[model samples]
Target: MASTVVVIGGGYGGISVAKALDDIADVVLVEPRETFVHNVAALRAAVDPDWTERIFIPYDGLLTRGTVLRDSAVRVRPTAVELRSGTRIVADYIVLATGTRSPYPAKLDVEQAADGAAKLRATRAELARADRVLLLGAGPVGLEFAGEIKSAWPDKAVTVVDPAADLVSGRFPDEFRAELRRQLGELGVELVLGTSLRELPGTDPGRTGGFTVTTGSGVEITADIWFPCYGAAIDTDYLGPELRPARRADGRITVTTDLRLPGQHTVFAVGDVTALPELKMARAAQAHAQVVAENIRTLLQGGGTLASYRPEEDAIVLPLGPKGGVTYASEVGVLGAGPSADLKGGLFLDMYLELLGAVVAR
Candidate 1:
């Protein structure tokens, strides 16, 4: 009998591994949503509500030989997964790829894609009506969101507040940070760093209203629209008690050198669910999927030396809207606008479609 591989969560990592092993094994992918949420374009989608539908790619075109279960995995054991519908599936190898969740409109709280689209449309309307926008976090999400708003509405006052004292990541070179600052200045964005908020705004994010909050530095900031842009909760509550210790202090699962759960070689974890030393980005997660896929393929072929995963030290590519952004890699120290745009502009949509084996209509 062929080895049955069951993969959970059809996000970037899950889908990538499943696609890699589709022809080699009986792959079963358990995912809740009917569509793959392309989180890379989420900020841009928020600014342009019409583009919301494009961010959600149907899972229908993903794997030709694999079966996708449009259901959530409520509990996962060493050898099987129990669905919320109470159905249990036994597999020879199980992959835990349930990623993390971020604040909307970067991520959707709704499980259904249609509902998610509706929420983005509503938020876009709110953004369109508001003249002043405040983003409460200076991480990639917050900075990119501020740029998105500025790109959509040039005159809108945008302020980014973060306790951290820097704009670009400190790990990157000074040239990278300098370029980031120049881009933000061109967009007319005011960044309030090294200062903590005394109290959070009473108004909910994405809602149009006047609100003022004082910073620890004795500066008062006000805006009509505000959003909380940082905070990612890993999705691992579905794992059984046996895997509890596998969950680390940082909320990510500890995987072996080969990306398998320690002691349980048949079970593996990937994406934001794993305690990878690297930054948790879709790019890194997909790389994890590649490594996991190779290991699983070896297991299916009856044992071979599994390849270990080593994260790239400075693999950070952030694109703010289609035109502006920054990128950093050791091979090429701190790339400029052209490189950033080339790396992560509208190309994401095309790349995903190709990955799904779908051809776009010209």
Candidate 2:
């Protein structure tokens, strides 16, 4: 009998691994959403609501041989997974791929889709009515959002606020940061660095309204709207008491070199669920799929050596809207509004999504 592989969380990592092993093993995928959401396109879709339908793809067409379970996994033992609907599935090898969570609409629950759509529409209307826009945080998401807004409405007064003393500090070289500042200036994006918001101004966060925001350094500024852009929270409450130590101080699971839970070789973890010392991105989840599929394959082919998974140190590529962005490939870091943008913002996103059997026809 072939080995049964039960993979939970049909996100980037889970789907990739299941597709890779569907032909070789009896693969079972557990996911909650009816469609696979191409998150890279979600932000852009928010600007052009017509393209929103394209970002959602039906998972039925992804893996022909694998089984898809449109349910949530509530418990995971060494050998099986218990679904929230009280369904239990037994497997020879188990993979825990339940990733993290982000702010609403971008990566929140499906039920919030209506709220997200309404917020996006309101934001667009607000942007049309307002003269200035303020964004909190300089992370990739915040920067990308600012870039998209500027590209769509070049005349709008756009300002990015971040407490970091330097933009993308320690992530890029001085030259790159300087170039980014120049580019933002050229785009009329006022960047207020080294300033922290003491309190969130009371106003329609998604609407055009007058609001005053105070910074940590006593710098006061007023804007029409503001958004909080921060890191995501990893969801692991379903793990229960299987691996107590898996939850690190930062609330992430720790995996071994082979991507398996330490001391529990039969069980494995991947994607945002693992406490890997690397940036949490969709590309990283794809990389995890390669290691996970290979390891599972090795386990099924009798006794064999398993390849270890090592995350790249400086693999950061940020696409800033549809025309520009930055990329840090190992020691070489390149910053511009062209190379990174054209690659990801233009065509690469669609290509990557198509590769995963999810694409929106333009």
Candidate 3:
């Protein structure tokens, strides 16, 4: 009999690993959301609701030979996973891929997945009525949000404020950063780098409304609304005392080179749940899938040797809305624009969904 591989969380990494091992093992994917939200396109969906419909991929058609459970894992032991619904699943190997969470609109919730796409579409009406926008945090999420806003509504005032002295500091080369600044300037996005916010004078900090935000530089920028694009809270509350002493500095579970917990080969972790020093993006999750899948295969085949996962030092890609963006690799940068953005950046969400056998409209 083939070994049962239970994969927790239905994010990019979980789904990819399950799909790859569907033919070789009895794969069980545990997730609470009825539909998997393509988080990569969540920012774009926030800017344009029409894009939201394509952001969610239902798991019903995902695996031809595997099974998907519409429940969340509350406790994960070495050989089994206890569901929140009091159900239990015994497995030969357990792959934990429970990713991080952000704010509501930024990251869709499980309940929101029901009609979250529709909610994003409805938000289009709200975003269109607003004239000025305030985005806190100059990280990739904030930068992508700004890019999406500029692409959808160029006339709207978009200001990105960050406490960091430099935008995308040290991650991208100097010339790449300059190019990013140039693009932001051409798109009419006001970059307010190296600044702190005193407070927001808006009534609805979550919703778009006429508001004024004061900065540490004594300049107040007024906007219709502001969004928080900083800080990521990882979802690792399920792992009990069985694996507590192996967390890295980033609050992520520490894993070995083979993506397995040290001294716990039966238990593996991937995606944002791991303590790797790589960017916690969907693309990185995909890369993690390839490594984790091979290790699982080796373990299932009697464990000759496990493969190690080495994350690329400089693998970064910023999709600036639907028209253009940038990609950085190994100290070199490439500007992705026009068809390139639509082909790779835009459809990346769709492509992965399709690869997972989800219903994705071209």
lDDT of 3 by residue, 1-362 (tens): 88999999899899989988998999999988878888878888877756767877788878888999989989888888999999999999999899888865678864556578666765676778889988888877888888998899989999999999877744567766776777788889998878888975556544667877788998789888777888888867788677666666566899888888887878888898888887777777878888889888987877887778987676567767777776667744455555337545664765766776766664
Name every residue pair that clashes in candidate 3.
209-224
> Order of all candidates by TM-score, from best down to worst?
1, 3, 2
What would the per-residue lDDT of candidate 2 be over residues 1-362, giving only the tens digit for each residue?
A: 67889999888899888998998888999988776766766666656666556666668667877799889888887888889889999889888888988763356456334545565666567677877788887777777777777877888888888998777644556666776677777778888888888998788555678888888889888888776666678777777576666778767889999999888878888898898988788888889889989988888888599989887665566656677777766555674666777557653556556656665576
Misplaced by over 4 Å in model 1 are: 168-170, 359-362
Which pairs clash inside model 2? 324-337
Candidate 1, 1-362: lDDT as tens digits: 67889999988899999999998999999998878888888898898855788877878888887899989889888888899888999889999999999999888888788998888999999998988898988888898888789988899999998999997454778888888889999889999999988988898878999988899999998889888998898867787887777988767899988899987879988898899777888788889899999999998888989999886585677776678898888898888778899888783888888787665443
- Give me the displacement of residue 234 in model 2, in angstroms: 1.0
How high is the CA lDDT of each candidate model?
A: 0.86, 0.76, 0.80
Name the runs in model 2 displaced over 4 angstroms: 105-108, 111-123
Give TM per candidate. 0.97, 0.92, 0.94
Number of colliding residue pairs in model 1: 0
- As for TM-score, the candidate ahead, 1 or 2, is 1
Q: Which model is ahead, 2 or 3, in terms of lDDT?
A: 3
Please give the distance, in angstroms, between residue 250's alpha carbon in candidate 1 and its true position after superposition: 3.0
